[model samples]
Target: MKLAMKYVILYVNDFEQSMRFYRDILGLPVKMEAGTYVEFDTGATTLSINTRESVNELLGLGLTADVPAASSFEVGFVVEDVAAVIEELRGQQVPIVREPVTKPWGQTVAYITDPDGHFIEICTAVG
Candidate 1:
């Protein structure tokens, strides 16, 4: 079967903090916002955030925001300039874990984390 990805939902601990980071700092437009869940309009695949309590209530699974030390996956955004984005984030008092760097393949990339510790990658388009 052919599968298409629909959304990436982050079960965040602090809903308000994560919302500000995504909506204000990262500057993603809100597509939909309910009391417990918020979805951002990010192309075909929607980037969303929800509360931990809702996940357990809906899925019946004890989901928590206790992320691992090492990130298993990252939500990446393709931007015009990685350095510019990093600078903007810095000015907002957001702690950037990694500065922009050019890889051997010639793509500039940087790293930052959201309030709930989800790795966010800011990079230029792939060659």
Candidate 2:
């Protein structure tokens, strides 16, 4: 089967707080929003956020009670300058998991945690 579109859904404990963080703080354009869901248009793939309650109801399971560890995975974004972006995020009082550092493979990366403690990596390729 072929995929027509792709999306990453993040189940958040607080819908409104996640929405504000992605839309206002990260500055992602809203694709659609409802009471318990919000989708951001990220050009190629969609990034969606949903309330844990909504997901639990949909799956008929207690997944909300089994929140994964923060460092299990991370959402990444490619930026022109990891250092500059990190500085901006710091100014906004965003929690920084790690300061920007250049990797041996010629890339700079920084890590930050979202409201729900999800890892977010801001990185740029080095020349």
Candidate 3:
């Protein structure tokens, strides 16, 4: 089977806050938005955010627990300079999970968490 469209839907606790983090802070263009649902154009893939209440209603299941506490999954953004991005994020008061550092594979990488506590990585390849 072949895929026509790819999207990563994140269930966020606060819809507006998450939207601001992606749309305003990250500067991703909004592809579409309807009430509590928002989709951002992330080049090849789409990143969407939906309220947890909407997700529970759609699934017909009631989940009162907080957002999932998992760090194994992350959305990565490729940038030209990791340090410059980190500095910008710092100015925006975004939480920095890890400082920009060169990895063993010759790539500079940094980590930050979104409003929903989802991991986001900013990276750049080094020669």
Candidate 4:
């Protein structure tokens, strides 16, 4: 079986803020934008942001805009230098959930949480 991940959807409170953060700060290029939705091209995958209420209405659920704890789900990015990325993120005032640490698997990683509390892991494999 061949499986591939296509996109990741983030339910956000303010689409504009999230869009700016992802596009301007994080440097992801915008692919599409509608009234309350924006999509960014992240190499092979896409990152989409939608209003919380819109998501709930589309899914027919009662999902709220309350950001959950950091342990919910993590987005990992393979970086050339995890430390450098972490430093840049810090300079941008992005919340750093965890400082850079070397894992037992011989990888260096740092964790950051987005405005909605979603975890993002910046990592570099030991060579």
Query: Stretches of candidate 2 above 4 Å error?
Result: 1-5
Give lDDT for model 3.
Answer: 0.88
Ranking 1 against 4 by TM-score, winner? 1
TM-score of each: 0.93, 0.90, 0.89, 0.88
lDDT of 4 by residue, 1-127 (tens): 9989999988888777888788887888999988788888887988888888887877876767665633588888788889899999999999998999999888999999777777888889566
Error of 3 at 96 (Å): 0.3
* Clash pairs, model 2 backbone: none
Best by lDDT: 1
User: How many steric overlaps are in each model, in order?
Assistant: 0, 0, 0, 0
How would the candidate models be sorted by lDDT, starting from the highest?
1, 3, 2, 4
Name the lDDT value of residue 25 in candidate 2.
90
The superposed Cα distance between candidate 4 and the true structure at residue 91, in angstroms, equals: 0.9
| Candidate 4 colliding pairs | none
Over 37-123, each residue of candidate 3 has an lDDT whose tens digit, in order, gives 999999888999988798898896664446475355998899998999999999999999999989888999999999878899999
Worst 10 residues of 1 by lDDT: 63-72
Query: What are the C-alpha RMSDs, in order, of all predicted structures?
Result: 1.5, 2.0, 2.0, 1.9
Pairwise lDDT winner, candidates 1 and 3? 1
- The weakest ten consecutive residues by lDDT in model 2 span 62-71
What Cα-based lDDT does every candidate model obtain?
Answer: 0.89, 0.87, 0.88, 0.83
